[model samples]
Target: MLLLQQSSWALYEPVPESYYVHQKNINSVTFEENTTTYLSGQWQYYPKQLLQTATPTRPSRTVLLPISFKEMGYPQNTYGTFIGHFKIPKEFIGRRIAIWIPNQYGAYRMYLNGDFLLRLGKVGKTIQTQQTENAPRFAYFIAESEYFTVTMQVSSFQSLHGGLENPMRIGVSQTVNRQFQQLMMSIAGVCGAVIGVGVFTILFAIFRGVRHSQSQGFFVFGIFIIFLALHNLFSAPYVYTVFTNIDWLWGTRLEYIFTYLSAFFFINYMFLLNQRYLHPAVFTIAVFVLSFNIVITFLSVPEVFEKLVFYSFLLGIIVVLNFAYGFYQTVNRHEPYSTINLWAVVLLCVTFLHDFLLSLNWIDSVNLSFASTSFYAFLIMVQQSKNYAYHSSRIEKLNNNLLCTRQIS
Candidate 1:
């Protein structure tokens, strides 16, 4: 029998804590020969819901899904089921196990060995009937048997993508729970830092910008950072556990709204900082993108609005790339504050791409993009402070020159 393998090098094998199973996009199931067997390969997919009494037949198509359903070529706004088989490592049998879904859109239910295990949100055939889950969740169950059959029924009426975007993992309940807590702490740190930075910049812009006026960028940028921070906080699965008042639906909606607003303001901030390097066309593109987001938010239902946000995020990449090119030119010209701007742009571009991938379920990691925003704001504030001092000195020199000229006359 052929067992699934990741690569030729055993040195690169999966760690003991977790095994990254190879998943196929097809809809079918393969039972194990023995209780010790590890099942991998194509999982049967049924794009329609299975009746409570029905069992799935052979899947119609086979594909790979290391990312979200939108990228997996699945039809938008659909419901489906995925069935696969896996075995518990003998050491983990009888131990408490936690199932980890890195990312998925819509609502879903999980079953183990044909028994109902856990469900997130509400899975229904229609949008009005369906409920959505925004935060990540950990489903802990006892490994009653060595061999397990798993099924996931998912629906996505509100999101652009559905199905399992990233791979799932099963590990000891304690270990997984610990990891979850660490992730929460890391995200909380990011949120707190962003709020602190936001308040400082906004105040500086109001008091200081009133005099210099060049600090307008700080005001817009501060608001943008706050939105981005909220997005991160709301998206983290742990937030729901702490803030029970916030439901998955509104939390997710606000996450989308904040993301769209942040992108809109980000372009404005960049343009304010370096009008020489930025072009009217780039600003126009940003405006068009923001307008599209507004129309979608108002015209479409919350579910659709949330799903469509990914497209806006894609457009944001283009905006950032444009800014990167402009910053490169500034660096070449050795303009005042250009060095700081150049580095900040580079850092932002990298973090933006990282978070974008995470959003699409293309990658999974603790998001550090919020931290980058703080760094960028700090650099811009420093540059503005320097410019203020230079202006004051220039005025002082001119007044001195006027006095000497009068004395000579």
Candidate 2:
């Protein structure tokens, strides 16, 4: 069983051995254990400015998981730490023990048995100096004693979300590593697919010279996908491999900036797709939104501008809804293929809104926006090809008619 106790900063003592062992069949052993059980209970939380003090005082109160710094009453840009101690079971001794963390919001240090085992990015006092390492990491230490302690000092000066948002687990090294590898592979494959499609569509438009509004629309959509993919990649922990030593402030700024760019191009793409509506104001709105995002990116660091991103996204929703409404009205006007565009735009807007809410901590839902967006993009690509063919056929017929008329004359 887990224990929750409040104390000023001090070393955690081993728990009494009389407690029952929660074990099951793991790794051919008669009893297996879930690593999460070890981390489930309350932890001692220290808010703001972790110092190198020899003995930090215990926390004043408790904070729960699935909570953010904003909700915790911490200012926009702040840092915090969480400390937890768990008993090493007699059975775990002599085994290569490892701990797996699902998600950590920012830079952090993981300590085992009072020894620093792993550091993700550089934890610092401010965003300017803080280097964020956002990656899944695990360290192996032979269980030498009957108890062990895990302390995490996590710092966040950029994101709206902060702290330990997911449960961690301790288990055999091989099992944990395998799980982490699988998760990384899945993310990599998805990112690869988006990049591939984005590149192909953009190249096709460029080489074809974008003769009509339909082709231009496709090109804009491609740009949106490319930037969206970049945003996802930069937001991942693995990005540290490529951009090692990146300042946390700049990294987050770029991530959200890419997001804004994607939104901008998406609106432009929608307008170009259905030209019969011919609304000039939509283009003006897209330009205004894009300019706003670009100005803010240069004006402030992430901690200050992060809130603006959310609000700007909220404002962008108005543009998205307007586009969808236009498409719906076009369908009423008996415009060809307008129904398909209407549904696609509606679905895309919903996905975008859901993800925005998820980022803001207003709601929790599995983010399937990327997958849905990809599906709709593919459909649009196919339809754009058809539109091009249709226009070509009409032009060819018109030329033939003109030639016959001149011959008769």
Candidate 3:
């Protein structure tokens, strides 16, 4: 109890929590210096309305920001306007302020204090006119006064759910810039590491291969990891898409392709490892389904392909179960390092489940993408190491036999 109390006391934040907008009250909120704040909480929601002007209007309802429109009783292809207010501190008036707008479901235009600001894609009233583009962006404005109003005109015609799926960050230039840079750096570092491991794994597999050995497992694993890494690097609503000159539609397509194909390779890897346990028919079916999904993803638009993700996730669950059962059988047979392999499978499965649920919006939170990637990379390393040891032992035994024959001669 004493230790718990001490730890709780140690969790004190550096700044006060007085900056939050409560019950539509922005006057009492004071902007903190160098502190990043998410522009969440209640915002005016006007459904089926798209305004081109920054002029404020009466809202039909108030809904929380960063909420899925489907959960809020809105159907697909909903268009709306959202209004948020935050007051700048007296000292910060006339100074430069920055807002970090993360990716949302559709196209949007941001306005601050009745002035045109950031426009991401083209917001329109109909499917033909509406151009959807999802990406992380930033907007800067000089605080003309203490009271600042943010107006957003948004539309989602090609997505499953509309409205702001991600919370926007608001802060001073220095703090926001630092946070953005750190985010990008961290993403780059992680993807770079995954890519390196994949390359090394492929090379290692080639080095260990001979006329009699099955080294294609490692090769397949390495290829999948590379694709997965690419998926992570060029994830939608991220900076890499901007660098790659991809809009949300193409970026999302790449995500689905990389993700599905990586699973495809992984399934083949499993079949190679436990051919008897995983039936050939089942493996073939899985491959066919994944391939079909990839084709449909490329041909169909966002609305059409997004619905197919649920079925893909269902297939993924079946695949994970197969892996679990195979590992369990291995452990029961008392094979060497079987226990470790089983536990690794369990860890990998858990991460897969977490991300899978998040994708379905059943988790109501962000996906543990990087964590899942790390766990996968760890699993790859473990299996590769095991393969390496087995080959080394085999080589040693062959060398010993040759020496014995020479001595006898």
Candidate 4:
């Protein structure tokens, strides 16, 4: 009962209802303590124009919020402006309201009620004049009027067409901040759990001894878990919120590096496990392949991340191939824990494919590296249990033989 009482906050968290604009404005919205809203729908879009504090003129067209860079024929490598019209209950006049622009690609200047509130990245008319930033932005202001206008000037010169790719959030200050807090907390919680799995895996490997057949691979697998967690941390919104001034380039580099290491360590573990079936020549081939990708990453610019996206797909293929062979070996040898390996490989491959398509921008879903690792860890633990049983029986037999020989002597 006490546990349930403590968890009641989870149930009481502000629930957000999504709302879209119609006829260029959203009206009759009410702000409450326990609710927030997504500012979506159609907004006035002015192409190739960067407006200042003045009201936007007749829009050249309209684009929906949460639209992709290519959606609705939205052009790439262009500057633009968006105007959002919203009306709230009069009770909000004396209270504070906040707008949250979730982290995503692009850079912009934000204005509310004809006042400049945020300038995240340089918004310019040309590529030479723009600097792209992908991070969350927020502003709070006392509502002086029932109707408010939000104007944004955005530039998409150097990235996957930044613009307004994500929906902005609006609510009373507390509710909006609470939403951001929850997002960060969820991400941190997942990362922390993955790290715990990693530490336990390492400890288990040590307990089994360095001479154990699975120890090397199991230890490396633990390292992979740690790398995976770090990669997720850097890639998530949590890092952006903590390191507000972090360059997009440096953050991405760390993310990419960790991603590469995680894949490498996991693949290495696979090689170690299948040494009987895999030749040393294959290890050389794998190293050469990964080394090439690493070299290119270090030599290239930030744009390398997008251009080298093929690397992500290639990594996915390698990961799936390694797991497939393990599954085959397990089934062929009739390992007692083969069932666990089968399901682990299948689920890992599925998650890898999900992330694979997500990398290519073909799908939208949660990154499942942590889930995949957890599944693999479970399989590893089960296999270790089998090894312990086998080794214990052998030791017991040795003890019996020694005792009988001593008695005879």
Query: TM-score for each prediction?
Result: 0.71, 0.74, 0.84, 0.78
Q: Candidate 2, 117: how far from true, in Å? A: 2.5
Supply the TM-score for candidate 2.
0.74
Residue 91 local lDDT, model 4:
76
Sort the predicted structures by TM-score, highest score first.
Answer: 3, 4, 2, 1
Q: In model 3, which runs have C-alpha deviations exceeding 4 angstroms?
A: 1-24, 27-32, 52-59, 210-214, 337-340, 382-409
Model 3, C-alpha of 45: deviation from truth (Å): 1.0
Best by lDDT: 3
Whole-model lDDT, model 2: 0.64
lDDT of 4 by residue, 102-213 (tens): 7666678877755677777688888778777666667777776676667788877666545666667778877887777777667667777778878888887899796787
- lDDT of candidate 2 over 253-305, digit per residue (tens): 67777777877777677667764433677568667867787788878866567
- After superposition, the stretches of candidate 2 with alpha carbons farther than 4 Å from their true spots are 1-39, 48-59, 76-80, 87-92, 121-133, 145-147, 166-169, 236-247, 275-279, 338-340, 382-409
- CA lDDT, every prediction? 0.64, 0.64, 0.71, 0.67
For residues 214-265, could you state the per-residue lDDT of candidate 1 as single tens digits?
Answer: 6687788788778767766665453544445566566666666666777777
Better of 2 and 3 by TM-score: 3
1 against 3, candidate with superior lDDT: 3
Model 3 lDDT at residue 157: 89
